[model samples]
Each structure stands twice: as structure tokens, then as C-alpha cells.
Target: MIVIIDNYDSFTFNIVQTLAAAPPGAPADWQQPDIRVFRNNKITVQEIADMAPDRLLISPGPCTPKEAGISVEAIQYFSGKIPILGVCLGHQSIGEAFGGKVIRAGRVMHGKTSPMHHDNRGVFFGLDNPFAGMRYHSLVVEEATLPDCFEATAHTDQAGWL
Candidate 1:
């Protein structure tokens, strides 16, 4: 099972919907995975582990990582044990949990679409280098403050990575 920890974000359901099906270019044999969603504060890391999830996904939220319930803790517990995926606030939580500093973005983007440059690896393997993606964030993970273990894969013209 794939577990999603929602951080009280409005887009949490939207993300779940997107994950429900294989995208257009995906392999034809791809099957819909069993996904379970829970509020960040409503569940504990130990309980999540009991589910034996194949993936741990943290949803974006409207506050800092310290304010998001269990988001950082989940990252701490599942780092080496399972693959963890974090979105906007979720991404910041990963950085915060790993000793990186999270702060206000130089340019806050809300409900806007922006171009992103990626290494064409991981989720971007078959996509173009500069792809347009939705932007909705006021905070960012400081690249300079990131630990040695965390390397950025995607970047935008405005901020280093989001």
C-alpha cells in the first residue's frame, strides 16, 4: 500500500486524483496502486510503518515544516526504510528534518505556472528539460542551507528549487 500524509492542504485530494491513474505516457500494463490517505496529525509514524507501505508521501500545506504535524517526524522515521515523496511544504519538511533551513522565498508564487529545468532523471526521465508546472508557494528550502545528503534535481528561473 502507498500511504499519503495530508498536511491540511487544499490540493491534497487533487494530488491523490492525479496519482490514481497512470499518466498518458506510462506503460500500458501499469496498475493502480492501493493508496491510503491520512491527515498529518491524525497518524503516527509507527502506525504508518505497520501498514507496510511501499511509499510514504507527504502533501503540501500552508505553513512551515515545524508547524506541520508529524511531517518532519515521518521523514525522520522512514528515510532509509522506505521511499519518501514530499511536495511543496512536504519537500521543505524533508529538508528541515535533515538539518536544512527553511525560509521565505525571495519571490512568492501563487496560482501561477512556471518553467522548471530538471536533470531529466527520476520522475523527469522522459520529459523535457524545461517544463511548465504549477506554482503555489510562499516558502522555500534554501539551497545553501541544505545538507550534503540532499541534492536538488529541479530548478526554476526564480528560485533555485521548490
Candidate 2:
């Protein structure tokens, strides 16, 4: 099952709606696209894993990565054992979780549809061209911190890859 993890320190209507709108389809191809909110600053990754999600998708939240006190070590613990998708902090967590570094980008990228570069296998599967996607983050992955197992499937001047 694809579990869309609510990374928020708290739960909100948007997070609920995102999950309600898109529930997992099947065990083999299940994916939770909804934005579940942790709603509480005390929430932990182990608590998230308890939900029995086959894969994990980190969603945006009120807490910043640094303020949230998220440990890459915790995320690393859940690495290849399960499929993980990091959105804003989610993406950053994935990088940091797996020995990659994350830093604030020189500039901010906001809005829909931006130019991106793909290495080999893009983030969004089946799309061949530069993809149009949502953006709402201030940090970017450090090139030096990127892992060999990961590839830059999509990119923008502000943030690269999903």
C-alpha cells in the first residue's frame, strides 16, 4: 500500500481532504496522495510506520524541517525497506535521511509548471517531457549530498527533482 504520510505537526482540513479525495487503490498499487497532517510536533516516524504503509510519501506541514527536529537517521531507518516519496520537507528528508545534505536554495520557486531537467528515470513515471508540478518549498537538495541510488528525474532553477 502506498501511504501518504502526514508530516504536519497537526491535522487540518486540507490534509484530510487530500487523503479523502485519493485513497489507496490496491495493496499492489496502493498510494495515498492525500496530505495527512501529523498535527502534533511530537509525532514520530515510527508512529507513521505503524499505519502499515507499503510506501511512504512525506507531505508538507507547518513545521519546518529544522524546527521539526526530523532526523535523517530515522528516515534512513525506513529507506529501501519501503518506497518513500518526499514532497517539500519530505524530499529534503529523503536526501538528509540517506546521507544527502539539504540547504536553502538561493531563490524560491513558487506556482505551477516550471522547467526541469531529468537525469535518466524521472520522478514522475511515464512522463517523458519536462513535467508540470506543484511547488511550495524554500530548501533544495545539496548536489554533494545526493545519493547514487537517486537520480534527478525533474528539476527547476529553484529546486530540482521531486
Candidate 3:
């Protein structure tokens, strides 16, 4: 089962819809990908983990939860044991969770497709080399802060790191 952990209500719906609409044999076509959407908002990390199904997909949100009164630590602790796919916010959080740093970009960029530096191997399957993908984020990651487990799969001068 593949689980998508996020506070956004639409996160699961979007994933479910995309999988249903994917071409035959697409990665998301989950013959029965048990997709579980978790809302850790206003809840404890233990409670969130208890509800987790399997693979985790962390979605993007505010630059930092402090403004929203949310701590990434709790969620990170729970996701530590599970396979996780960090999206925009998810990516930043993953880095932050592992002693990485995140900061707001001087400018805001939102669109489909941006070049990325693939320092890690086999991160973007099917791609000949490192390239761009959809991006809708205002915060960027600090390379030095990222843990060794993560590779700068994609990046752009404007976005700093991805």
C-alpha cells in the first residue's frame, strides 16, 4: 500500500485521481495502491504514525510551520521508518527533518517544469539525465544543510536547490 501523508485534504484526492487517469502500467496506476491520506494537523506524531498506511508522500505547505504553529519534527520522526516521497513542502521538510535548512527564495516561481541537478543516481527513473519538472514552491533548500541520504536531484539558479 502507498500512503500519502499530508495535512491537505485534497492531497489524497489528487493522488487518487492521477493514478486512476494514468496510462496503463503507469507508476501510479496502483493495481490497488492503498493510498492513505493523513492529516497530522493539530495532532501528535504518534497519532499520525498510528494512522499511517505505508509509503509516504509529503506535500508542500507554508515555508515553515512556525507561523502556522506546526512542528516538522513530529511528522519527520514518524516518516523516518517509512519510504517517503517529498514534494515541494515535503522535500523541504525531509531536508529540515534530517538537520537540513530551508529558506524562502527572493522571488516566487510557479509553473510546470524546472531543471534539476541530479547528484543522486536513479532518482528520476526514465529520464536520460537530470532535468526539470513541475515546481510550485517559494522556499528553497540549503545544500549544506541537506543530509547525505538526499541528492540534489534538480536545481536552478533562480530556485537555488531542489
Alpha carbon lDDT of each predicted model = 0.83, 0.57, 0.59
lDDT of 2: 0.57
Q: What tens-digit string does per-residue lDDT give for candidate 1 at 124-162?
A: 656776989889888887778777777678888877765
CA RMSD per model (angstroms): 2.0, 4.6, 4.0
Decide which is better by lDDT, 2 or 3: 3
**TM accuracy, model 1:** 0.90
Clashes of each: 0, 12, 7
Cα lDDT tens digits, model 2, 25-80, are 32323244433444324557677678665555566665455544443444676777
TM-score of each: 0.90, 0.65, 0.68
Candidate order, TM-score descending:
1, 3, 2
Task: Look at candidate 1 and tell me the lDDT of residue 2.
Answer: 71
